[model samples]
Target chain A: MPFEVYTFRSSGKRLFAGKNTPHFHAVYGIIAHKQTIMQDIQTEMRNRAKELLESKQAGLVVGFTLDEYGKPTPAFITDPDDVGRLVWNDDCVRSRHNLVGCLKRDEVRKLGKPAVVVNAAGKRAFNVLIAESQREPGDVVLIDMEPEPRDARFDERYAKLAMLDTMSREERFAFWKKEFTRCFKCYACRQVCPLCYCTQCIVDKNRPQRIDTSATLKGNFAWNITRAFHLAGRCVGCGACSAACPAGIDLDLLNLSLARAGETHFDGYRAGENPDTLPIIGTFSVEDKETFIR
Target chain B: MPQIITRQQLLALIDSLLEAGTKVATPVARGEKAFFQYLEKGDAPLIDPAVFPVNSTKEFFFPRHEILYTFERQGTEVLVTDARPFVAPQVVLGARPCDAAALPLMDRVFGWDFQDRFYQSRRENTTVVSLACAAPDAGCFCTSVDLSPETQAGADAELLPIDDDTFEVRVFTEKGRILFGGKTSESDKTGRTGAAPDRKFDAAQIRERLQTAFETPAFFSEAAVRCLGCGACTYVCPTCHCFDMVDEGSVDKGRKVKNWDSCQFALFTHHASGHNPRHDQGERQRQRVLHKFSIYPEKFGVLLCTGCGNCVRGCVDGLGIRPVLEEIAK
Candidate 1:
């Protein structure tokens, strides 16, 4: 034994309590008492995963599994009977990443049809992919994370950005510089993001390299700014970029800044909302205000 | 030399090190997590024995971006200058033993066929002072790879906590001895280190499977599917040293710099002729497992990993070496 470590299992009962009780309690839902709700979600997840695989609706079901820490990890279920591996819970980062984005990966695509978790962010991601002809809606079977879809995450994402709105550009630059310095250029933000499904990212290009690939503060600043600007109107407000960042950077704030600009600055535009409509960026408005250019 | 030091004395020593212009690197609290970073004066070392910093200690030795050399062209002659061949003295305090153990494994490669002067310089100048772990998380598997919480493989000094305020210090190298010559006092009470974590997998079995099972791709069959192909795991890994060299400035005055690279990148093996030997993420993941268990071990007579679980903690979904090893061993 490793000197009594805390362990939280799928069962609601306590497994092992160690010195880090308060921390484990906070993470493991001992405080929330969410057993009943989580159990229901688990059953639904297994059932949906099983049905998708059995009915040939999906060859794979991308769901959740509890890791060694009792935190959610990705469970890619290819066998219907193996849906037993799946777990379900709230307070988890959605599907370990963007579900819509996973469909584009060659490994996942090789598995045939994939059913993936879709929360508020995922639906928008799916919608954006559809509009851009990146994926077909029929190809994916969505596992809705909420009983009633709410934009709580979306509201919180932009709500935090209101402080940035009040700050001068210099203060804002300082704030982001402090955050960007922590980035190791791991690209977790890009990997987890559904909208960032390009075969070749701009930073990876070698011929006449557009951005400095070094993890210097200046390089990070340019990369982050370019990343935000590129998704000016196409981000789905998933918050996965922020969730997946190991450096603990507020990447959501950067994306939300662009999300806000897409709405308030560009004629109330939002991405991944509707597949039939055109996006704000690619579509030009001749009668538009060009005052910001000055 | 004294053999015991109170927490206050340790803190004062850190201040002294900083005062003497020696770079002090320690795990410092960054938001909810602690990260191993070079500390400025007055910056407190986390000192929490249980907390594993969000990053490994490798970056302090082999940084993310370093100038290999600078070049200036004049007519037919080119003047080349090596950058930062000698590093200032530094101390790494509160490193996880697993992180410390990795230094020896890395030293093998860094000093192999071609000596990496950049890594060698930093390694020579830094003294590793590792903290014995008392509360390892479930993913930690030091025992599985022949390491323990207090393993002294790469540490210049070891600090075993006797209580909330004192540690039983043991020095291994001259650098460590010089750093703490008289700072500690002998104490009758010695600190106890945690027993090795429960062995998670059979290393010999996993290594054999990796050596023979290239066609099957057995263990990481579908698990690698969930991989986001991000550098998080490799970057956090203490022994995963892959880098790319690129010229920064224009032709006239450019510096050749080496930037950290990961095998998980889509273009890591993409040849100019458009052939990628590691065709997919699954193959790339297979390469990682093979290198750690089969390839490197065969060449060097030691496993390339320290079982720190940083890859698991840092990965997008906690799918790292342990899971694959455990599955293959089964």
Candidate 2:
């Protein structure tokens, strides 16, 4: 009943070879082309497989090749020489869909059937495959996809958005006001938002009626602004709130504006990346930059 | 001339209106507790004009639990059906100035970016009749905020109690005028003498007091340690607008509903990866204050509070905002 993991890799001829292919080959294996290259790849995969097998790390190894149309072919090789062609490349293996597609091929499936462990990416590959056709945690599962970098930035657009650094106070206020005025207080933005989920809101507190309940222009303005400020640097820009608002308010603008300000004011700190990182207002650093503070 | 009824006569008129097929909702006493309830033809004994109700009029416009849309699936295919729309037109009577003032604030959020047809439809059809405060409570601080006891900013028709029984009705909008149906007389006088002499406090002095309180060293330090992190304050607040969206039932068939949410809960900022951004109560409390005092004022020209004192009355731990504001003002 334990979960099992399976790893897979491609064993096709190189249609295009570059830095990624070399990087991939360094970890997985080289394309089975010249005898020398094939021998080198075989030596590497064997060294890796031997290390795992000796340590009782992985249960199986599955290697594959591709057809002329870039589709996974039915040909596979467990032999170290053939397995040597399975190299890792960033560009070639960047997508999960591509790896999954190649693994589902008939020839690859056969190789994967008995594999209790898979080393799909070649570098630090581990996944468990159970005997009952299930998956386990320790089983090494591999696919022909590029491995994530240590400090990779997921969205480059956020970087670009963070670079604008030229918005004035008036411009920022106007932008936020236009967006906030459209709020309907349906709380869809707050509900779908991962950041705004509090058990009891201060606005709802009756002890002093901190915020009014009768949804008005003034009240909505206060509520929306307060929400945006609380999420100032902490928003991950998931766009969940904007997507969920029944009022069609462009809340992303408010969040992004603050995010942009946070970047401009503070050395471009992003939220949700480091759990240990304190909020912008929570901690004060001696080397903190304060050009934006008036 | 149309009848100028006393308080009892007005109640009779409300009963007659209910008898004539109009849905009338007013603040009614249910034992010790009072809430806005449906006023039937013979519920005269239940109507209370003393204080603002425990519950808000938001339910009449937007119910706590409403089915936004329903989905039914046959095999792998799914069909989504919109829920029944809001159509009933009702009257909200005996609304306080703060509660009445809250309607426009709610409208901003609902009408901004997206138009909430359900809330809009109910709002467009309903008439709000508010009552002026005869005597203000120590906890009542609407005057300190952006409103006053007699402010009729959001009410369709404002009723000022002149004596023990009679009231001078002031119609503020066309809707209010229409609701009177040419029965009520109009007067040119801007101000009328009624109720207790209105206590006058300098808006500038109140603002100064608030400004001084915010500078007090204990304001943040005291609030940080005492708050138990419960949501009772936000839930009872006239302006709190946090909510949660949940899909009830099976994936094949279910309804997506939005329910009221509070920020005091630890899980409010919990991430899918088991990380919470606002993990501590102090941070949450700081967020509460900054949102109301600093951020809201910066975003909107007005402050978020109307000084209804609900939070003062509802706080279980005596960590009420008035003391906090007083500490801040000190």
Candidate 3:
């Protein structure tokens, strides 16, 4: 779908007269839901956008979409009558000038008054009455529409797997073993995982070949067990690893199994519940249960 | 009739193959430890048919620190440089069954939505020659993961140690047959035919045992408490595929690199905004178990563990998984 980009221009005054033009330059593109922008915002935005898109807001602009290499693409509007066609593109850019003209003319003719402006930034300084000043280029004009918050239930489901600690150990083990055996050892599970961003790995240390270099059954067992244990109570259950596994290994089962154990043994707790909280292992409480101690 | 090479002849074959332009890598003895090392003609060591290797074979396909794409910057302009293509076909000898199986698992991740050309290229060009296990370790349980010492899940050719000096080599793929120069002898082919040992416990029995173990407080409290939260097991595992991605250099210009990651570390799942989800050894321990037992199986319809027992031998605190499984099996 095409997106309309609106550049605000005030009547009787020029916003862009010279090289140092004061015109407001805003680009709008139809970003696909679940596409990333920057690391953080992109992650949240994609989750929200995907929800909106799935709910049938086909032409809605959930947020800005990024390119294949995860870079932001510039967008602009070129058509005035096609204002309604503005939709989100994952990383594609469109002209904004054309979109704004179409949106303004259409609203003025239909509503008999000023059109609605949607301000993504929600800046209070730009909250001016529609008719107060002639909208000019670079003017901090507001869009009069309110975009609903995007729902991220699917992505949320991934994050919520950390809470699946109610299952018994047998259930957990049966589940994870099948999942891990499918592992191809591709670093995608590590690459796409936000939690796996370490500077150096213990396995790569030359001082000791802590882990061996062959893909033998013994090696695979050691690696997967170590990985699962490492992520135990701390895993946020984003399921990014499971999603990223090319062999279709069920990485979430491993994360969830650990989450379940932590909850049962340590007062039913899981990871990622509080993004601001410390990991369970890093923090020790006086009331920490040590029943397992001999 | 295919030529039947004796163990001495096989070693000669390896030497000749190494001499014939291929880079041969095989398990070499380092003091008491064994690891895969590049061979120079006469130096390739014999395959260890009793134990599995500790490390994954990913480095051969995807090097630990590979230059994905190098770029040179010149005053607001940047020129991208392609990485050097891998030269020479390599043969991996003495790989275990579970190790061989791991290639396809890793292949799925590398060839997923975004194709990793470097990994694919190496996988395509290299030849893998695996060995069957003659003796299973105390912690070895490939049978539990639907694999056995004789399972040729992902091997091109499999070698069974018949005696100290003779090997029964079975070619499973076209690449292996070509490598063996179409060596096909009826006696050689029929000599190694045998079904894998029937694992005593069925899935239901295992599940029941695991369920009972989970119910008993001893399983979780006893084994998990001793874990020092070090990822020694993962670092040495062949199938554990977790990794971390980082960028080196300043924001002006840098390259993103991927490194191995272990869940045992406290900061593994920590957020950039100063929050960590898995903060405790217990939680981390739980994650380790679940990832292998539950989450991985849920997605892939198979257990992630190859049952090679590296984790059992690698852990410092003796928080090996075998005892835990044995308890669960009880």
Candidate 4:
């Protein structure tokens, strides 16, 4: 059975309900196996963090630590001995969270170099940040979570997104409209995205007031659209934004649409796939395929 | 003497209120989480005391975004129309006692200087019915903030679960009594408050530390590094009531509105002169603690936080008040 893709929140629910197609089945088994993976990777992560901090290879280790509530939370450890707090788990909500984004923060910057934990998607976004000139490759170290290179694991990212494609355009619009209505402009969706590392977000600007500041349906639509478009060709499909939304909006679906387009329209170009290659958005191609464009 | 109503009767009560043209807000299950939303016909309200809504009931009184007024230009003559605050008679059902307590704590702020009719009107028109916590999670710290699962600070009435079939209603105010008038039958079986949430910190100690910790930046910045600087925690909180006002729409014709703002945002204190007193996220974090513990309490004679634990639950970064306060007390 193929592994179903999603966070512990929705995935556990759907798995318990015996829902979703059987093609993406045994998500529970995969999660259990992922825990076994955690045992090995957690040891590896702690070792790497310890090495980085002890040798001063990195001034800070941005990783996951269990909070008092036993939830996997983002932690910053500077002391070499504190590396034991580091962890890797299937439910590490911070697993896909691009801890690399923390390198841009003042408090984190004051600590010198950062050694960040990153899954495939997090690594992709890290590369995107570099391509966009928001970061330098030398600025932070990446400790990859995947024990081995597995594009098949990344394939699970679009399992639910594939289901959404069955809906008509009107149905899609209605689906999103209802979802956007719940948004109260908390900006959790924006704050969590690695690609959305804007110093002054468009929503915050009031000089010309690019978008409505209200949380009205129209205003919310505007906000969500702005957030989605801004990350177009750049979003790494990390699911952090969707997981972060207290409104329970599945924002990753919007990113999936753009991500799939990035591969198709840009001749199999993927954001942050290669550090040496220029970004699809930043560098335009004369051979760029487009049916919609005149 | 307390009055009793069966589970079926309580749901019927919600339907009856909606049928009678009264707006009702309750936790309605949506996907994996529950949210406090207005109930319509056939909408199932989560009456279970264990279900904590992701968003607060504060929006019922102080909406996320509300029109202050509207204006238009007619040649040399200017015209203005004041936005009448929505004051429809509403019933907030199945609110946690901690959430209910936020109302009175906030009332002091809204009604202190200039009676904010927007909030005061809703406060006057609504009756809050809180469900006494039968099952409190680790996130809950209501007991630490001078509130219990059955605290009646702002609730008009309190519901106690006798079993899956029954609830004992304890009326606190005249408004609560009138709302439940004739709906309940007198019963000797009192609803239990259940186990109290284990106290996480002493509110007095936090307030005391905050008084001196104002100048100490490390205490706050320790947590600030991980804070994502989003409005999630503040918006979900029952008592975090900071707002930004702006004229929305064109200059010729538009409405002035107040929208929810958060101290966590970098721009919350950004000055017109490009100077900010709260220099960093650490300062902002400090302000949040000091305001809830020291500033508001010094002014209102009560702690600003009700310890509903929504902030902890809603924080995307998993950073919240309890952890910070506990760190301080330790």
DockQ of each: 0.58, 0.01, 0.01, 0.63
Which tens-of-lDDT digit does each residue in B1-330 have in candidate 1? 338999999999998889889898999987887899899655778887878898899998889888889999989899899887757889999998999999999999999999999899999999999999887687789888877786898899989989899999999999889988989898788887876777567788888877678864656655568788889899889999999998887778888889999998878999999899988887888888888999999999989999899988887677877887787888
Candidate 1's C-alpha runs over 4 A off are A1-34, A93-96, A151-157, A284-294, B74-77
Clashes of each: 0, 96, 111, 0
Order of candidate numbers by TM-score, starting with the best: 4, 1, 3, 2
Candidate 1 residues A1-294, lDDT tens each? Answer: 111111123333321234223346568757544455456556766876787789998888877778877787777788888999887654353343666666777888889877877665777788787777777657677775632344345456478877888999999888888789888898988888888888899998879977887888877998888988888788887777887898988788877888887778766677866676577776656665675533
The alpha-carbon deviation from the true structure for residue A124 of candidate 1, after best TM-score superposition, in angstroms, is 1.0
Best by DockQ: 4
Lowest summed lDDT window (length 10), candidate 2 chain B: B188-197
**Model 2 TM-score relative to the real fold:** 0.48
Q: By descending lDDT, how would the candidates be arranged?
A: 4, 1, 2, 3
Q: By DockQ thresholds, what CAPRI class is model 2? A: incorrect
Which candidate achieves the best lDDT against the true structure? 4
Candidate 3 chain A lowest-lDDT run of ten: A123-132
TM-score of each: 0.91, 0.48, 0.49, 0.92
